[model samples]
Target: MIPLKDNIPSRRFPLVTLTLIIINTLVWLFERSLGPSMENLIFAFGVTPADLFQYGLVSQLFFMTTAMFMHGGWMHFLGNMLYLWIFGDNVEDRMGKFRFLIFYLITGYIATLAHVLSDPTSTSPLIGASGAIAGVLGGYFVLFPHAKVLTLIPIFIFIQIIHIPALYFLGFWFLLQIFNQTFQGAQSVAFLAHIGGFAAGALLVKFFQKYRY
Candidate 1:
């Protein structure tokens, strides 16, 4: 299920969310321009669990943060940005710009750590904003459970648009992550990070919103 939009509208401009999207887009374009050198960039910035554990957290902090802004491919980049565009604004509206930014980064960092812990011996570089965007989805789930998400569901040969409540949509998404993590073993994607980020976001959003109230 791909979320197209949500029923909730932002009371204020989602400046941080748009800025993040622009930055990710520009970074992606720069990565494209690098040609064969893109692999080097991903290795340098992306979080590799083995490298992270060996080097220690203090030294690997930069990579942990940079990894969130990096993406493995066009689909990876676009998919993350799409979810952020759909759900981030409402979360941002609820938490305010600064809090939302901090929330995003914190949840992302936690997500990366979760991935690292899940497979400490793995050597592949972990990159993308899905974990962070998953946090935004988590926040949306708690803050706007009643909001309807316009989603595109492809049923083999047919495409259908459905209005799914935020609660059910996000709940299903989280469950899917758990199911993937349990059955799929190790793959290119970090399903644990998504679970960790969503759990963190759902847990911390209320605390962040307390400042607003």
Candidate 2:
């Protein structure tokens, strides 16, 4: 299911979200410019579990932030940026630009930490902004549970668009992450990080609602 858009109206322009998207895009472009040396770029910026385990906490902290902007490929960046565009405005509306920016970074850092804890011995470099954007989705769903989302459903050669409630879409996604973590044990994506971001967003959104209002 590809989420096209959500129904929530933002009170302010999402400058912070736009800025983050631009920054991520530039960083990705810089990585691509290096061509074959992208391996060093990825290692330098992306989170490595073994490095975190051996080198104490500095590498962990640095990568926790950098990893959010360093995506693996085109599809990875597209999916994450799409979700961020869809849900980030509502969150930025509620939290305002500055606080929302802080919220995003905090949840992202927490999410990366969750990934690191999940596989401390693995050498795979964790990358992408999905965890942070997953947090935005989590917070947005709480605020606008009944909002309709335009989604594209692709079934092999067949494809169609459908409107679905925010709750149904995000709830099913959360459940799928849980199921994956339980059965597959973090093979493909960072399911635990997604869950962590979701939980952090849900809790932090509630905490910041009064400030927003």
- Pick the TM-score winner: 1
Worst 10 residues of 2 by lDDT: 204-213
Model 2: residues with Cα > 4 Å off, grouped in runs: 55-59, 186-188, 210-213
In the range 174-203, model 1's lDDT, one tens digit per residue, is: 999999999996578899999999999999
Clashes of each: 0, 0
Q: TM-score of the candidate numbered 1?
A: 0.96
Model 2: which residue pairs collide? none
- Please provide the root mean square deviation of candidate 1 (C-alpha atoms, Å): 1.3
lDDT of 1 at 124: 89
Cα lDDT listed for each candidate: 0.91, 0.85
Compared with the true structure, the alpha-carbon lDDT of candidate 2 equals 0.85
lDDT of 2 by residue, 58-143 (tens): 64687778888988788888888888988898888887788888889888877877887888898989888988987887898788
